[model samples]
Target: MDGDLVVDGNITDVDDGAAALIVLGNLRARNIYLAGDAKLVVHGHVTAETFVGDMTDKLVMIHGDLRATVSIFWNEFCPDLVAGTLHGRTLAPAYLDLSTAPIGCLADPAPEAPLSRLLAPELLVTGAPGPDDLTEIGIRGDALRDRLLGGLPLTTTP
Candidate 1:
């Protein structure tokens, strides 16, 4: 639960039924699969190094930040953010359920620089020059993941 938790195999705890697998430290895994109704609750943070098993699994919830280097294909990607931040290099806007995903804060025109960097850039898009009814943008999750991995933070600039 401390250092790096390298899970080279599979994490299948789909029968827990809402139970939380809380981790005190960071988690480094290659492939993760959450089935049934179990919830993967991490207190520190999770770093999926290799690849995520699936993205449709919404049972994986993190209290801390999540850093992934690969593309996570999901029907919808919306993490239950408590106090931590989101750092996916390429998790694009198109994969987000804007209706439920908290992309940007309308309250703050420009969010804090530090906090913005820790989160995905795709979450900052509003109404661009496109379809008026456009709800999602086609952005790559790996791109955002790379930026976060490369230590590039999201910025508010023209």
Candidate 2:
């Protein structure tokens, strides 16, 4: 798109063949969920509360800087490349290669807790939860994934 794209709620699915979403300008959203071989290319900066990629073939390329509170490469096949600086927390499997991108504040979930239990999807979209909130009680795994796939905001307001 030409100008900045601002999404008040989450940007989910976008599972097209290639380059599902392309933005010439900046992109700002509450959260972004990419799956099913989805690809997102942002020429300008990206500002989101949370960014999650959940497919082996998924790709998220940001030419400009990216600022996200929580960024998760949920699947081992997902390749997230940030050409510019990346600022915020990131969660990824140890097997995933994120060396190409400079990630700040990488958070690893406790051994007892799986990656899915790290954060509450609803709070991620509706409230401002920091890295410390990972332990907070909330939905997770299938329930969270289903909510994201449903593409309905947990609350009417962001």
Candidate 3:
């Protein structure tokens, strides 16, 4: 239609001094709006369906499908945004697959899961078939939200 643009990746650093960086080397315009100030050094799996910016241009980091619509700046780059990011609409699109599914537990994990950069083919956690024993592969929903945030320890209740 007229609202299906996407931006892959770019902007290595430019929080200030005028701002105006760009990247998203593909998939353009889903009512997009990423302003400027460059700073997307995540490299590897990159994606973007739609998202606008503030906080000096994406300083609200939370890499992994930033379905930004209009305004949602929490600073410190996605400060564990349990209720932020998702402006205009069309949430979830920063790259996901958790190997599949509703992304088991709503994605956003990762503490130290490097499984050799994974590519499928059984993600055995460690040695004698790990992952607490095994049987739950096909993970990708942003790496099962970074493995459901293993180690779990980032408070902010209220």
Q: Per-residue lDDT of 1-158 in model 1, one digit per residue for the tens?
A: 54446665445453534566667666766434443455666666676532232234445556665655432334344444434545444333464643445532111123333424533455333344333212343334344344444444323331
Please report, in order, the local distance difference test score of every candidate based on alpha carbons.
0.44, 0.62, 0.28
Better of 1 and 3 by TM-score: 1
Q: What is the C-alpha RMSD of each candidate to the true structure, in Å?
A: 9.8, 7.9, 15.1
Task: Give the per-residue lDDT digits (tens) of candidate 2, residues 2-76.
Answer: 778999888886565755788998999877887777878888888886677766676667877777665666545
Stretches of candidate 3 exceeding 4 Å from the true structure: 1-4, 7-13, 20-76, 79-115, 118-158
The local lDDT score (0 to 100) that residue 34 gets in candidate 3 is 33
Give the alpha carbon lDDT tens digit for every residue of 1-158 in model 3: 12232433322232454553233222333222333454332211223322323234443233234432221121112322212223222222233222242212233433433333322223223334434332232222232223222422111111
TM-scores for every candidate against the unseen true structure:
0.45, 0.66, 0.22
- In model 2, what are the clashing residue pairs, if there are any? none
User: How many backbone clashes are present in model 3?
Assistant: 33
Better of 2 and 3 by TM-score: 2
Highest lDDT scorer: 2
Task: Give stretches of model 2 more than 4 Å off.
Answer: 14-19, 100-118, 121-139, 150-158
